[model samples]
Target: MHDRFDFLKNISPHHGEVLRNVLSKETRETLAAKLDVMPNGQTWYADIYQKAIYGPMVFRDPELNIIKTIEKLLPNYRILSDLYLEKTPDDQGFPFHTDFDSIGFMEHPEDMLTVWIPLTPVEEAGSGQLSIVMEEGAVRLSLIREANQLHSLVRVVDSSVPAHPPFQITQQEYDYLERTKVTPSLDAGDALLFCNAFFHKSEDVHNGKRSAYIMRLVRKDAKFNKTRLLALKKLGQNLAVVDELLKQHYPDAL
Candidate 1:
């Protein structure tokens, strides 16, 4: 399944660290070591990028743990999708964009977040590590909401197809993102959680491959849940994507 928790046992024991009991350090080390030795398989999630595999729900405890973590941070939240994995080659990197806009249609971008956990130790920026814009890019996000055109940001990356040319913001918006972009050094087991609407990109890998898992968290009782649901249906999201999303989120309903 390539999900983060799938290879928890592979992580090193002494390196063990848990963030709010949601992520384990040993699991991170194990996953990294595993990626280092395992032969690369067929590309997964080609539609989103070259290497990715959007598999079935692999871990339920992680989702519950995430729920507990979010509740500690802020209450009344639920997950929007299952644990998803992505593998990027040395050459593939993404352009500046927000997961909120790309996946959730920016319906309530501020209320959502994307948790990125790299299985392998990512080198400095431009070495297949994440580059995040440091400024308060949420100002632009506010404008999208005020204009009631939030949907414009959705579908930027089709979950069903490889995202060719990667999605980038408009030239005007690029100026802000470029000014604040910072690629921080991240070790295995370190989890990067950011606003879904935060401007971020990836550096091309010069070292080896990069493996990571991402999970989306949304408010269960968010004000715009209905609106988001309508947009997802209208977009004709792939059945597998939609089904897994619902399964992790509304397990009893399924």
Candidate 2:
């Protein structure tokens, strides 16, 4: 809808308790059991990320209280069909970056927001949690005016395995983010909804693990360059720019 960049909305004590069971004891036991059989450097939560990112949660109960609440808060927007899981095992959190977006917000940042709900909660003093900078309105408006394209990542390597992630920004920009960021600690039934323009990341976990369900909600009326996007095979035009990021950061990836 071409709106101003709204900061994160702390939505908690939601109907998420109902959703938590989906990742049940059976799920944990099954995943833990697989560790002996898993390949090197793999954790169960990461394994879940790969398997669930685009595959699990094919359907949602439209009548669920949480779903209805999200729908109400996000008028004129529709949630994407695929809901996925995020697992932050001990000692791992993500580098700061905005969306690892598929639709690629392009010229409209306000038209999209990420809905992050923790199935299992974390204390405010917890070791591993999400930290973000809720930029002031003028800076936010200006930043997203470029469609939130100029964003940064921390904890990324110049060259190594799993190197050269996409949607990165300049080091100076990254420095500003590091100085200004604050952690958002969620309760068991809590959900954190943040705008597409904001840059966020996970801090390394030092204790118990974290698991959450994440999904994207986009305005139904947002513009799309369907023909050209289709030509790029869904990676879209932004990916070309990412190639430079790869060369600059993880030179070995190319």
Candidate 3:
């Protein structure tokens, strides 16, 4: 993994207080209630499924103050997006993958970063633990066809007309994942930041509910094509308003 973890740690300050306030008992109860009604918001892939709730952008929410704090810590960068809450159970985990495929326009994938903050304490034995592999190792593995390429390769495979590579996880693949995966512990407010290119996954929730929020950030000079963005906006699915919002803030983010 190139020891890039230090860079991520350097950019983000200790925001345990802010995280605690945002995930306070009342907040968790309210969000949990929302989850009860919006189970469909959960995202499922292979071995893992998670309830994802978005927004309350850094511009409006107090918890988002972390953005500014991070900016100060890494003054050369700017946050590209808001946060996403992921709730998982002992039964929910994902195949190893990168987050780049889910977001659009990856012309320069390495420029992006994701900060995963656990809302509860996590341990190796815990159901929803984060797993990450070395970036260098993942890059080498990508060159070997038989290696498990859950994120990028999976997306390409899924996009094929007949979807050539089926989505099933092989036992060998699971064993490889188990061998490489590392469960990093985090208190309710601590966050782990890593490059988007990193191969990572989560363990199934076995005991307590695993709730986390992921925030995507990018450098200020990152290129975001406004025209293409508007074109996608015209398609007008769930992200139509997001296009309008981006245009308002970045005028050039189209």
Best by lDDT: 3
- Can you write out model 1's per-residue Cα lDDT over 118-194, one digit (the tens) per residue? 76677475446776643435335433532333444233223453333433457877776667566656666566665
Model 3, residue 196: displacement in angstroms?
A: 1.7
Ranking by TM-score: 3, 1, 2
lDDT of 2 at 107: 37
Ranking by lDDT: 3, 1, 2
**Global lDDT of each model?**
0.50, 0.47, 0.51
At residue 91, candidate 2 shows an lDDT of 39
TM-score of each: 0.61, 0.56, 0.63
The residue-by-residue lDDT of candidate 2 on 1-254, one tens digit each, is: 11223333331111111222333444434433433243332323344343234423322543233455556665666765334444444334456655534435333544556666655565555545566656463235335533323221111221133333343466877777777666666665455666545567766655556655565666666554332233223333344433433455446645
| True-structure lDDT of candidate 3 | 0.51
lDDT of 1 at 190: 62
Error of 1 at 61 (Å): 5.2
Q: Is candidate 2 or candidate 3 better by TM-score?
A: 3
Q: By TM-score, who's the top model here?
A: 3
Model 2 TM-score, 2 decimals? 0.56
